[model samples]
Target: MSRWLLCLILVLGLTGCQSSAATNPKLPYAAWYLGFLAPNYMEVWLERADISDINGLIFPRAMGGVVAMGQPESLSATARGWPKRIGSGKGRSMTGLDLPYVVSLRWQSMVEPQTYHAAFLIPDWARRKMVESLPADCPVSGRTSDYRKDLTIGLAPGGVVKVWIMGPCLDPIEVLTLQAEIEPKGPYGGKSGGKYRPLSPVVKAYVDKYGVPYGSWWAPIPYTTVGP
Candidate 1:
């Protein structure tokens, strides 16, 4: 190989090394090291909210994989973390989540384990059957709106079908519903023919023992920090 060509390659290699350092530049000491080790290890605050218009939260995947939360504006500076979260594939089971018959995911992203708020989204219409299923403390109050959405799906189902909440994550009671009819045709796509599954184990046991705040999608949960 030519000496000049070899020299050029060495210079480029050194520059690339320097550029890599700036990728995660200026991060907090802990966030840097921990995030460097495992981005999923990062944990931040999910501020409290009052989701008058929202009704449920679902995590299709957790741990170090992709995570989708909130809506288009949910990630914006002023957006309430209560977004219509969409996950890439079915996730592992939590105490309350059921993993099958899920569909029409809007967006999907991975978690970085830094302090960040995970938003919740309310189904546009509440299911009369699910009305009793909502948290006991959940107030049955709000103007009704049409349940509406569009999307694609898989030909074969995998993982938990429905994910229920077990914490104070916010959602709208009015928007809650047992999703509509589904007709899976083939892999890589399908339409939302009004299909959804019933969520279980929504609120933590503490709330069941002692009542807590009523959150809504029409409203934002109050700004309170939850710790690492």
Candidate 2:
């Protein structure tokens, strides 16, 4: 083959390898999205929260493994205002062959007692506690209400993982407290709610095991955006 042609082939081969590596980075855990959520949303929020840099640390929670020193490309895309398809906002669950993952949110208002809203998916023990601690018909709307905070935890073929949201806040201290409440706890200790079973298997297990429908463990980092 001509030298020029051979060089072109080599360059093309290297480019293909790089692209493949980007799509599958040999992550420590099997990462997938559940429900209507998408990684893109978290990417956007992370940038807005000023957590643009994770310091080259990638912790894969589900598989109980670490990814050494590598930053996520999604983080960069989010910083650059890349277009993404978040969801329809109509509320739907993800199904089929993809792995399972959870998303949690905690909204903390600047109000007194530092009212916090938390949500997550954990083993049965933690969920039961959350349910008992939080009011059944907890009001979700108010000027300083912790609404829109939710937890989605469940099993995917790989294992379990949690995603959490904490904030748009004026007080850093309050945000810290809200972040501390979502850590996982022991197994279920209370009665199960038959009426709530159909809501979400992952959530139900949490309630059945811990009396709380979600675990609490979230810490808010800063996020920022660069463009209009």
Candidate 3:
């Protein structure tokens, strides 16, 4: 059995092992990550069965590498430390804004740790709002996409944004699904405006108890910071 199958089996067994009364509420992003990783296993099995158009299978593993390593506590620690690393100039510049943003890191493959991609995504409306809200001294600037690597967006702080490190998958359905699940929700329970909130309590508890440990800083396409 392949590693993916083993993982699935393990998950299934754990689910079965628990009492029915022990059920826990699910996390939105956790489902998204599972969706992202499922296709890779499906593709692997299909390939072994001599199926065609197995390209879709590749993205799950690539994306799984990211989800596997994106532990919330670790990420929170990273966020807390970033202000210091960026130094007084950039750190103060970033902290002055009132918006919330996302940071994502993507690794090239499960094995290769030092290669990855990073990006920042801010909506145009958010940028305008930020400019209007903040003082003139802390104006935001956009970064151009080189295509080869690197993507940056500038905006006024305090709007919803998503930052992801994705593989070179021609089809991004899985990626889109995952994004939708994790994207912020508004105050009235819509899309997140601009902030990082913990996943639903059930989901948070699940991750705290069962999710894999995340500790990679050298992934290819690694380390993305998106915000106000």
For candidate 3, write residues 165-204 as lDDT tens digits. 1212111111111111121232212433432333445335
Ranked candidates (TM-score, high to low): 2, 3, 1
The regions of model 2 sitting more than 4 angstroms off are 1-36, 41-121, 133-140, 143-149, 153-228
Give the per-residue lDDT digits (tens) of candidate 2, residues 6-84. 4533443344322212343232223322222222112101100000001111111112111111124333323111122
The positional error of residue 199 in candidate 1, measured at the CA in angstroms, is: 3.3
Off by more than 4 A, model 1? 1-22, 30-194, 201-215, 220-228
lDDT of each: 0.22, 0.22, 0.22
Winner on TM-score between 1 and 2 is 2
Evaluate model 2: give its TM-score. Answer: 0.19
**Candidate 2 lowest-lDDT run of ten:** 44-53
